[model samples]
Target chain A: MHIPDGYLDLSIAAVMWVLTALVIGLSLKKVAESKNLNVPLLGVISAAIFAAQMLNWPIPGGTSAHFVGGALAGILLGPYAGSIAMASVVAIQAFLYGDGGLIALGANLWNMAVVNVFVGWYIYRLLERYSKFGAAFVAGWLGITTAAIFVGIEAGLSASFRYPAFVAISAMGVWHGVLGLIEGFITAGIVSYIHSSRPDLEETSNAVISKVPVAFIGVMILLSPVFAYLAEIVGYSEPLENVAEEIGLAEKQSYTGIFPDYTIPGVNEYIGTLISGAVGVVIFLSLAFMRQHASAD
Target chain B: MHLLIEKTVKSATSYFQDFFIHEYSRKTYLHDVHPSIKLLGTLAFIILSISTFQVKKILLILASVYVLALNTGLDVGVLAKRSSLFAIFSFLIVLPVSVFERDVVYLITFPLRVFASISSLQLFILTTRFSEILYGLKKLRIPGMMIDIIWLTYRYTISMFRDLLSILVAREARRLKKTSHIETLKGGSKSLGLFLLRSFEKAEEIELAMNARGRKISYRGKYRAGFFYILYISGVATWWMML
Candidate 1:
């Protein structure tokens, strides 16, 4: 779920914008490395994901979802470019289709695209090294969850920073955490099928682990504050549209209390653990996975 | 010319913000507002519309629509017709919700939430121009690289879609006659898979061309900034928040 502009404070919104920009900048440098790098093809994937999003599959909770596009891009194009590609899709959706709001670009990009890019690719690379099937399955699985966690973080961050609202980070985290697993299965199945048909392509792929790591780390550092600023903006207040009355859009308000409504179970704790586990796995696997791949080769 | 402009503006006003139909291009009162503002407006409206089951707020939202119809010069008849597409889809999914729940309040609230989202979205699409909206974002200093990928991807999408269509056609022709529905289904899927593989190769070539043209991710603007001034006239925007 891409939140709109003015959902968050300007300060937060500004921070997100900075992070998204940094990711894009770094992607370009990486793209320049190989002349044979496929632009239109990745572009096609972006477009298809954009179009496909219009067709959502039904999930439980009376909700429907389409492709996330981030993991798909990561698996196909590698991580850095993958992040940029997914962000571009969000941009087009914002500007052209208005699916995602212009202001929430930072949050959406950071959550849906950036986090997925680094986490998905790194995880996929590691998993495949040990067992191709395992890697593909995990890549697809985490790909879906990465966005869920990111969205949860975003919703959590937004609630904490901007407004004390109906849904907290924990609520969103649990909600999307369950929601994303469905996507993970679909993503894994698709990746496994594709990789099986073209396993050689993965090994020969231009994206070696070492080169990508440096780029992502550098980019992440520079963009973190920028993303923080953008999130602050969207999470905070923004000018209202030409409505006769002001709508209930307060970017960030001081939290009044723990939260009420939604008598869901240890909902918050479960979400917290889920996010923590995902991060732990991503960090642990990226290092251990890369080493395993290197040794296997 | 004046009559046509009036009619077009009217058509625009009536449509629930049909994103990126920049037929009017340069100027109209609505043209100058920041995209972020319109986005926030819609978000606020949707949230507000959903949070209440009161007839009063629904009427307010409806009134907002009427005002939109007046300001944008869209015909009430045409706008209502377009509005129903979303209605049809919403009703498709929601019919069951209302069917099973039966409780008036429960049925009503969720449907209204859907309606509010659909209508507010239409309002956004009708009012904003994609390129100008993008210009506004660029001015806001969103990354140059993301913008570049979007621009290139957009330019290439139509062609790629067309290419897939042709390949599908040729593949079908080579197979002589139509097969069982299931057979065609399997064949069709495999062909599309290959198309994806080829497209990956296609991206590499485009990247090469991009590099050859001296395009870097952070390349200084090759496009004129004159247009940004048109959208960024709210010179005090940055400080507007600070104050």
Candidate 2:
């Protein structure tokens, strides 16, 4: 799931960096405003998450899969604190172990820390009233699958990558979707155990997602396809390439370039790019953000 | 099943243990360079390498990185060996793309760039201590709170791993018979749940301990750029500009 450095173009990487920075900055403020911000607790929990990732669960076959715990972090801590914890873990993985690329750290953090945590938290909160265990299961399952979808979208969007958006999306989405079952189960089991034994620690988060944010997210989800269509109709290419064409350093290979043109074979470029981008956004923004009620207990 | 748990613990322990021990025991000239300079230099090299699609330029950067690694007393073979895992992964991932596009260049350029980038980062980590890197980040004006959290996270990761290893060992010791997959899942969840609770309690204890001592956590470092640091950065800059 860790996208190495060369896999992403500079432009995509920069966009991810900006988005990640924005989310982290907002998270920092949210965490600061909370009365019970425990820095040590956050750090230790981050460490535990990092180490616990080493624990593997047996799959149906003779193989094993490790837990990612992004959703678990959000469930245990609040979304804001959970993002920070996961960011620390991801950063350490890159710096210490070289498990991920340095240049791609921003994208890695965006997918795992921001997208995974928030989405998981949102899913869990939305479904909590129905069933705690089931909510956790879906949160854990969907959180990872969505993150993987983003990875595919990012890679697919990059001209440097060989695969188109759909192939990348399917490969990443399908594999993780299947793996997420185990993730879902483990997350639900752990959450259930903690809830039964230590209910005080179960509902650590008091964030209330009101109808307004839900409506806003719904609108965003609805608008993603429109946005993707409009961008494609405008013949979207790398920003730098636009500059290059303006300066006459590069010719306008709008329709013929491999992927810079954002053309999908068989289907029209607009529809292909639109479908890819829209699906990416729908999966992403569905649980990406939440509005906390000011008076929530 | 116990073998699986033991293998995971041993691997995790070695990763934490071998790194700190390897880093602390070495005192090369590169180790004396200012970490901020090294960090910036590393970022510059990585960006430069990946920015270009020229195989020649990428190879040049890789060679330069290898030469630097060898000069700094790092085993180039080990660094390359570690980085090759990512390179092979990159190659395999891009293989489908190259086959689809019928462009062999993608196969070489992507993996080569990944190798150079990983090698450059590993070189930086090899020469600089984790504390110095944090101090460098602090000097670079990253958030104080982020630095503190990252520091604490690094400090406690080992202790938490030890706790996990112990929990696994204890669980294994108590198991009187073979466990089913469901039982394994239950056991694993129990261990993780217990670990999380223990982590929260330890955090509370540490918070109190820190309050008794003081609240402020800061890293003070005298960052003096040596001749070697200057020369190294200049060389990297020259290479980047040349490309």
Q: Fraction of the real A/B interface contacts present in each candidate?
A: 0.16, 0.41
**Candidate 1 residue spans exceeding 4 A from truth:** A38-41, A52-64, A159-167, A203-297, B1-128, B131-145, B158-192, B201-243
Residues A264-293, model 1: lDDT tens digits: 123365663454344334433433432232
> lDDT by residue for model 2 over B1-243, one digit each (tens)?
585595586567767764564465566556766788888878867776777666766876787677666655667887887789989988998888688889898888988988898888888877778888888888888777777888889889878988987988898999899988877877888788888888888889999998999978878776546544445545443333322
Q: What lDDT score goes with residue A75 in model 1?
A: 74
Every candidate's DockQ is 0.13, 0.25
Summing lDDT over every window of 10 consecutive residues in candidate 1 chain B, give the lowest-scoring window.
Answer: B234-243
Q: Ten residues in a row with the worst lDDT in model 2 chain A?
A: A286-295
* lDDT of every predicted structure (CA atoms): 0.51, 0.75
Model 1, first chain, TM-score of: 0.66
Looking at candidate 1 chain A, the ten consecutive residues that score lowest on lDDT are A256-265
Q: On a 0 to 100 scale, what is the lDDT of residue A266 in model 1?
A: 31
Positional deviation of residue B1's Cα in model 1 after best superposition, in angstroms: 51
* Candidate 1: Cα lDDT at B229: 23
